[model samples]
Structure formats: structure tokens, C-alpha cells
Target: MLNALLFDLDGTLTDTDALHLLALQQLLQEEEGRVFSEAEFTTHVSGQANANMCRYLFPERSLVHHEAFAERKEQRFRQLSPQLQPMPGLLRLLDFAQEHGIAVCVVTNAPRANAEHMLRVLGLSQRFACVLVAEELPRAKPDPLPYLSGLECLGARADEALAFEDSVPGLTAAVGAGICTFGLSTSQPPQTLLDAGAHRVIEDFNDPQLWAEIHRRLDVR
Candidate 1:
């Protein structure tokens, strides 16, 4: 039986990917006069570590500068947190999970402060049983530690848990942890998610019966 769920925070729970991209673009433009398109940003920086993402965008800058840039981006993101909204059916699914004795945890590559801000702004800080942030681990998504730690916190084995993710790195981490994962196509293409090891993919959480289907699927085997 599916006893727990690990979820990616940004695009999966809230539509904050665009805001994050915008913040990065603004920071780059203001600091270095560099313009980063959404496509390029998502392709190279999204789901990557803060330092790695900074290096990819500012290869000429030093590690210290990269950290400074990341800090500014985070500041901008927090400023935009008020605009955050939960994805359709996300809260319903969370409520259903809680009501049915399924543990729900947030396992994301986002920094703890930013994740907390988003959750608080969306009035969902208490919805999850745990919020495992990237800062809590030495490595982030695509490393499997975040997802594994989330399952550990829930006292659930990988085989007994499911993960919901919308990015390749998040999906990869969850799948690599030996947990079944479903990809939501909010940030990237569904095909790319499946290619990244997601067992299933869906466009969004707009369907009313989606939770029923998810429950049924997770309950089997």
C-alpha cells in the first residue's frame, strides 16, 4: 500500500517556476547586463544546485560572486511569494492524503527559507508532515537524498511511497530512490519527465477524479 508521498515544491505544489525564472533574469540583467530567456534558464538552471546554476549563468564569475547572485535571486523570489498559488487539485490531494492516513512530505531542491516562505504565503506550511529542503542535505535533487530523507521522516519504505514531481532532476531523484514517481507537466514536457525516469506523466491536476486514480494506482502492489 502507498503509505506516503514525497512532493517537489516549486512547479508541483505552486506555480512559482516562472517567478523564479523572472527573478533570475532580473538579477542577471541588473548585475551583469545579461539577458536570460525562460527556455535557456529552465534548460540550464532549473533543478540545478544554486552554485552550479550560478556558474552556468555566470561562468566568468567566481564562486563567491555566484553565491551573492543566488542570494539576490532568493531575495527577489521571497518578495514575489505573495503571488504564489497552489496548483489545481493540489490542496485537495493533500487533504485526501492526510484524511486517508497517507503521509505527505515536501522534498525539494529549493532553499529552506524560500520553501517556508512559499508555503506560508500559500497557507500550506502545516499541510505537509515534513519539508525536506535542499539546504538540509549536502547535495540536492538528482542526488536522491532529499527524497530518501523524506521517506525516512515518514517512516515509509521507498516501495510504499510515491513521489510527485514536475522537473527532470526532481523526478530523477525520486525515481532513483526506488520510489514510484508521477510527473506533472507544469514546468517541462511530459515526455522529458518520463525520459528522466518518471513512471507516469500528466499535464496538470485539473481533473476531479485524478486523486481517485492516483490512490488506486498507488494502492496496487
Candidate 2:
């Protein structure tokens, strides 16, 4: 039985990718005189941890510089948080999960502050049973540690949980931890998520196909 649902906070639950992209674009232009296209952002930044993103974007910068840059970028994102919106049908899905007595958890590679900010803006901070941040774990996405920790916190087994992700790294992390994973085609193409090991893909929670799969997975009467 599917006892719990684990969701990625940014792209999966809310359409924060565009905001993040905008924040990065502004940060790069102001600090490094650099420009990034959406495609470039998808390839280099989306789904990546802050340290990894810093290493990729500023190979010559020290760890301290990277930390400062990341903080500034995240601050920009928070400033743009007023534009954030929950993914279509997300509220309905959350209601369904609650009505069914299914636990909900958020597992993200984002910093705790960013995650909390997003959740608060979306009015979801109180809905989740647990929130797992990659920064708090020894390892983050693509390592399975964050998702594993989320499952453990919820007292859930991988086979009894469903994980929703929007990026290759998040998909890999959830699938690697043995959960049945669904990909949300928000930041990445469905094919990319499939190649990364998603069992299924949907544009958002509103997709009837996603509901069909959820019903089957939970064996709902």
C-alpha cells in the first residue's frame, strides 16, 4: 500500500524554476558579467546542489566566495517569491492525500531557508509531515540519502511510498532509494526524467494520467 507521498519542493510542487532562473540570470549579470539562456540553465543549474552549482559556474572561486554567491542568489529567489504559484492541481492532490490518510513529506536539495520560504509562500508549510533538506544530510540528491532520510522520518518503506520529482537528479535520488517515482515535466523534458529512471511522467498533478497511476499505486477503492 502507498502510505506516504514524498515531493520535491521547487519544480514539482510549485513553478519556481522560472523564478530561480530569473534570479540566477540577474545574479550572474550583476556579479560576473555573464549571461545564461534557459537551455543553459536547464543543463548546468537545474536540479543541482548549491556547492556543485558554484563549482560549475565559478571554478576559480573559493568556497567562501561560492557560499556568498549562493546566498545572494537564493536571496534574489526569495525576493521573487511573490510570483511563485503552486503547480496546477497541487492543492487538490494534497487534499486527496489528507483525506486518504496518506502522509506527505517534502525532500529537497534546496537549503532549508529556501524550502521554508517556498512552502510558506505556497501555504504548505503546515501540510507536510516532514521536510528533509539536502544541506542537513551527509549527502544530497543523486545520492539517495535525502530521500532515504525522508522515508525514515515518515516511518515509511520505499515500496509503500510514492515520490514525485521534476528533475533528473531528484528522480535519480528517489528511484535509487527504491521508491516508485513519478516525474513532473516542469523543468526538464519527460524523456530526460524517464532516462533518469522515472516510472511515469506527467505535466502536473492535474494530469488525469497521474491520478490514474496514483489510484493504481494506492489500490484505492
Candidate 3:
């Protein structure tokens, strides 16, 4: 039987990818006089941790530089948190899960502060049973550690859990953990997400396919 739902934070629960892109554009341009386009942002920045992104984008820069840029970028993101919007039908899904006695967990590669800010902004700070931060783990997304930890926390088996993500890394992590991963088409394109190992691509929580799967999973109980 289906036992739990694990979700990604940033692009999955709320619509904040645009804010991240804007922050990146302004910061990158002001700090390095480089033009950061949407395509580049989606490819290199989305689904990645701050330090990892900085290292990948600026390998020559010192650790201090990476830390500073990550701090500044995160501060800017918090400033834009007030504009965050929860995914449509998200409340309905949560209510359904609660009524069905299914566990829910949030698994993300976002920094702790950023994750807290986003959940608070969405008024979902107290919703989940557990919040797993990839940064707090020895290995981040694409390593399966975080998602596996989430399942362990919820006492749910991989075959009994459903994971939702909007980025390649998050989806890869969940799928690698042996969970059925659904990709949200919010930041990355659908095909891009599928190529990363997502079993299904959904527009949002309101997606018909998502609801169908929800029913199929719970009806067995």
C-alpha cells in the first residue's frame, strides 16, 4: 500500500524559480559583468546546492567567494519570498493525505534558511511530518541519501512512497532511492525532466494524472 508522499520545496511546492532567476541575473551581472540567461540558469543552477552551483560555475574562485555569493543570493531570495505562491490543489492533496493517514515529508537540496523561508511564506511550515535537507546529509541530491532518509524517517518503504520534484537532481535522487518520482514542469522542461528519470511529468498538484495516481495508490488500502 502507498504510505507516504515526499516533496521537493522550491519549484515543487511554490512558484519561486522566477525569483531565483532574477536574483541570479542581477547578482551575476553586478558581481561579474556576465549576462545570465534563463536557459543557462535552468541548466546550471536549478536543482543544485549553492556551493555546488558556485563551484561548477566558477571553479577558479576561492571558497570564500563561493560562500559570499551564496549568502547574497539567498538573502535576495528571501526578499522575494513574500511573492511565493503555493501550487494549486496542494491544500487538497495535503487534506487527502491527512485523511488517509498517509505520511508526508519535504526533501530538498535547498539551504536550511531558504527552505524555512519558503515553507513559512507558503504557510506550510507545520504541514509535513518531516523536513529533510540534502545539505544536512553527507551527500546531496542525485546521491539518493536525502530521499532514502526521508523514507526512513516516515517508516515508509520505497515501493510505498511517491516523490514529487521539479528538477533533475531531485528527481534523480528520489528515483534512485527506488521511489516513484513525479516531475513538475515548473522550471525545467518536461522532456528534460523525463530524461532525468522521472516516471511522470505533471504541471502541478492540480494535474489530473496526479490525482489519478493518488486515487490508485490509496484505493488499495
Candidate 4:
């Protein structure tokens, strides 16, 4: 049986991707005089660190400058936290999971401070059994370190968990960690997510048919 559910935070549980994009755009523009289209911006930092993103956007900028730019973006993200909205059906799902005695954790590649700030604003800091921050690992998504670390903290095994994510990198990380992966359409198309290794993909969290399928999987495991 699946004993736990691990979730990706930004695009999975909350609607903060737009805010994150805005912050990154502002930082890149002010520091490097460059404008990135939505596709360009997302493709650049899809699953990369701030420093790497900076280098990719402004190769001429010093590492120190890039670091400062990243800090500024984070500061702006903190300011925007109060506006963080939980994804549809999130509360219901969480409540159902808890009632069913399934442990839930937020496992993300976001910095610890950013993660805490967002969760606090969404009143979700205490909802999760564990919050695994990316900084805690030497590597993040697409590497399995974050999810593996989360499983360790939850005292759970791969077969005993299900992972919820919305992006290709997140799905890949969870699948690589040996967990069953469920993809959300909040960030990508259903086909894209499934192509990235999601066992199944849903258009919305509130879909009764999808939840039925998820429950079936959980029950059978």
C-alpha cells in the first residue's frame, strides 16, 4: 500500500510559477539588459539553480553579480508569498489523504527560505509531514536526490509512496526515485508529462474520475 504522498510545491500545490517568472524576468532585465520570452525564460531555468540560470542569461556578469541578482529575485518572491494561492482541489485532497492515514510531504527544489515563506503564506507549513528543501541535497531534481531524501525523512520506501508533480523535471525526479508519479496539467500538457515518465496525467486535481483512478492505484498497492 502507498503509505505516503510526496508533492512538488510551486506548480503542483500552489500557483506561484507566474510570480517566479516575473521575479526572474525583472532580475534578468535589470542586471543584464536582456529580455526573455516566456519560453526562453522557462527553458533556461526549468530545473536549474539560480547561479546557473544567471550564467546562462548573462555570461559576462560576474558570479558575485549573479548571486546578488538571485538574492534580489528571492526577496521579491518573499514579498509575493502572501498572494500564493493553493491549487484547486488541493485542500480536499490533503484532507482526504490525512483522513486515510497517508503521510504527505512537500518535496521541492526551491530554496528552504522560499519554500517556508510560500507555505506559511498559504497556511500549509504545518499541513505536511515533511518539507524537503533543495538546498539540503547536493543535487536537486532530475537527479533523484531530493525525493530520495524525502523518502528517508518520511521513513518510507519507493513502493510505499506516490509522487505528485507538474513539470517534466519534477516527474523525472520522482520516477527516478522509484515512486509512482502522477502529473498535473498546471505546468505542462498531459502528453508531455506522460512522456516524461508520469504513470498518469490529469487535467485538474478536482477531477473525480482521476481521483478515483489514483485511489484505485493506492488501494491496490
Cα RMSD, each candidate: 2.2, 1.1, 1.3, 2.2
lDDT (tens digit, per residue) of candidate 4 on 1-221: 76788999888888677788888777667866777677875566765656567788768979898878778888987876666778888899899888888889998878888888888888888999889887677987877999998898888899988888888778888999999888887767688888999988876579775577667857633
TM-scores of the models, in the order given: 0.93, 0.97, 0.96, 0.91
Error of 3 at 64 (Å): 2.1
109 in model 4: Cα distance from truth in Å?
0.9
| Backbone Cα, N, C clashes tallied per candidate | 0, 0, 0, 1
- Could you tell me which 10 consecutive residues in candidate 3 have the lowest summed lDDT? 212-221
Name the candidate, 2 or 3, with the larger lDDT value.
2
RMSD of 2: 1.1
Which scores greater on TM-score, model 1 or model 3? Answer: 3
What are the runs in model 2 whose C-alpha is more than 4 Å off?
Answer: none
Compared with the true structure, the alpha-carbon lDDT of candidate 1 equals 0.83
Candidates sorted by lDDT, descending order?
Answer: 2, 3, 1, 4
Better of 1 and 4 by TM-score: 1
What is the overall TM-score of model 1 with all chains considered together?
Answer: 0.93
* lDDT of each residue in 80-107, candidate 1, tens digit only: 6676778887877787787778899999
* Candidate 2 per-residue C-alpha lDDT over 1-221 given as tens digits, one digit per residue, 9 for 90 to 100: 87889999889998788889999999899977999899988998898899888999999989999999999999999998875688999999999999999999999999989998988888888999999999788998989999999999999999899999998889989999999899999899888999999988988888888788778877775
| lDDT (0 to 1) per candidate | 0.83, 0.91, 0.90, 0.81
